[model samples]
Target: MLLKTFGWSFAVTAIGLVAAVFYGGWTGFGVVAILSILEISLSFDNAVVNAGILKKMNAFWQKIFLTVGVLIAVFGMRLVFPVVIVAISAQLNPIDAVDLALTDKDQYQQYVTDAHPAIAAFGGMFLLMIFLDFIFEDRDIKWLAWLERPLAKLGKVDMLSVCIALIVLLISSMTFAAHAHQHGGTHVDKAETVLLAGIAGLITYLAVGGLSSYFEDKLEEEEEREHEAEEQAKRSGKQQSAVLLAGKAAFFMFLYLEVLDASFSFDGVIGAFAITNDIVLMALGLGIGAMYVRSLTVYLVRQGTLDDYVYLEHGAHYAIGALAVILLVTIQYEINEVITGLVGVVLIAASFWSSVRRNKRLAEAEGSTEGSGKAEVSSGV
Candidate 1:
């Protein structure tokens, strides 16, 4: 099972390291290794969240995710995206952007950094919407019951998540971004960039996420109705089949997953500059990390890990919320990637332990109940 799940990731790692060594020798190898680890650490929560969505997809769509999706992730997010940003921000052509990245890396890095305000705002807002929708959702399992219950109740209010996201965008833009501009710490138009980018993020989330959810719910409803009709037919005699996502529903879900990945990668792309400005190395390292994340998502689904550790999804979303906040904060202040990575790992670890404890308590209670029943039977005997 392990081999079936992680064989590709292992192969990618070996090949990636060999290529890294060939490119920049030991230093290149070490940087690639660190970048891979960094991407995985910061994205563990991303894997968990991805599993939840991926599990609902059909087998065909699942294959699409591993194949086409992987290409998009590796090349589109890690390599092409940064270049595109540089091209637009630097007012250079695509070829010039690529040339600049290879020739004048410092200038490439600066262009990428200059684009941070808008990037952070867009990614942060999109992730914030995800966290908000999750927390506000009324679910059967509540990891943080005290807080989640209250928030879920408030979720009944129409457009609550959108309202709150807009409010956050306004505050962050007005205070941190605007203050930076006032102090000459950033571009004269930083606040406007943040505001517009944030609005775009919010809209993207609503359009993509909302459509995905709508279609998925519609599909589920159709399935349920068909199942009920089959049961009715079985009164006379018949059979049937079902699927969670198909056709339009699956397509939207696929699009949503890609967008979610893009949002998550924004920080990693920016942070990679701090380690090295070599775009090839960043792509190789981050690409390897991304493959592992995809593998982990598949493993979790096949293993039923989420079903066993009920709070894992909750922990992941909390981590995502922390990340969203950190991204927004980084707009004004620099945040260490170590802190970002640690926040996710710690939350997920805590949730795992909590799940263990819950399982133990339930087992003990069941054992005691069985013991009492046996004693009563013996007394009767």
Candidate 2:
């Protein structure tokens, strides 16, 4: 089952390895392999959260996500996006950015790193909003009741999550880049950069999420009408097959997912610099890992893994929260990719085990209830 599902992913990964070799011989292949591993580790939580949203989409959208989405993720974000960033940040043209990347690797990394504070602020705030909205929303099943229960209570406040995010952003702007916060001091202009970038991220999230919701609502209404039509056709002894077209709603959702993926990629792209700064190798390796993540997303949706592992979504959101904070924190200091990856794995693993235990307990309770019911009937007789 696993092999058939992930066959394409494995094949793409192999192709990535071959591409890496062509780029820099065996050493390039090894670098690609390591970067791929790093990307997969860092973005595992991204795949989980992606599945949560992907399952709600229709089959056509789902396929698009795995296919068209891969192109956007790999080429657009992994390859082109960094170059675009460097170009804009350094006031260089696209050609110049690529030239610098190829000819002066250290200068390229420096330019990219120099843009890190803005990147972190934008990506971090967007991610934090996602985490915050999830935690504040009311859910029947609480994964970590000890923590979630209290958080859920606070959800009653109007725009509470956004307020919290704003507060955090304010604190980070003042503290993370202390010099920039000083009165009329220009040692570093990080405070304004963080503030503006974070606001941009927050606004993007709101716009994308709101528009997607509106479109999805319309799609739902259309589906309901189609379902009614199908029932009428059945009553009239006519066969009807409802064709699920890729409508505006799905298109908006596609946009939403892509933006979400781009936000997630910021950390991974920056982190890849720690492994190797060779633009070609980094692109190949990260692209391969991205393909696998997309494939994994489809597998999860098809297998209904999220439905089975109920608390898995909770864990992913928590990991995203941690990653957001880490991104903001790293604007001033450095953090190891290994540590970031490990934290996500641990949270997801813990959630998986908790879900299993809950399922087992529920099964046992049902069994006990059934056995007692049988005894009661016999006694009544």
Tell me, by TM-score, which candidate is best: 2
lDDT of 1: 0.76
The C-alpha TM-scores of every prediction are 0.76, 0.77
Lowest-sum lDDT 10-residue window in model 1: 179-188
The digit string of per-residue lDDT tens for model 1 on 1-381 reads 999899999999999999999987997897888778667755666687678888877899889987898888888888787666557545779798788777877777676567667767877787788789889999998888999999999999988999999999999998767643222345444788889888987887777666656655765665467567667867967544434324556776677777777666754665454445477788888889888988988998888675677677677677667777877777777666556656766877787788778888999999999999999999999
- The true-versus-predicted C-alpha distance at residue 374 of model 1, in Å, is 2.6
Report every candidate's CA lDDT.
Answer: 0.76, 0.76
Q: Considering summed lDDT, which 10 consecutive residues are worst modelled in model 2?
A: 178-187
List candidate 2 stretches off by more than 4 Å.
Answer: 14-65, 179-189, 231-285, 301-305, 367-381
Residues 1-381 of candidate 2 have per-residue lDDT tens digits of 788878887998888898878878987877777677657755666787788778877888888887888888888989997667557655779998899888887777666666667767777887788889989988999998988899899998999989999999999899885543222222365888889888987997887677656655665766576668778988998866554433655666677677667666765675554445467887888888887787778788778765666787687678667878887886676677556656656876788799899899999999999999999999999
Q: In model 1, where do residues sit more than 4 Å from their true spots?
A: 14-65, 73-95, 181-189, 221-282
So what's the TM-score on candidate 1?
0.76
Model 2 has an lDDT value of 0.76
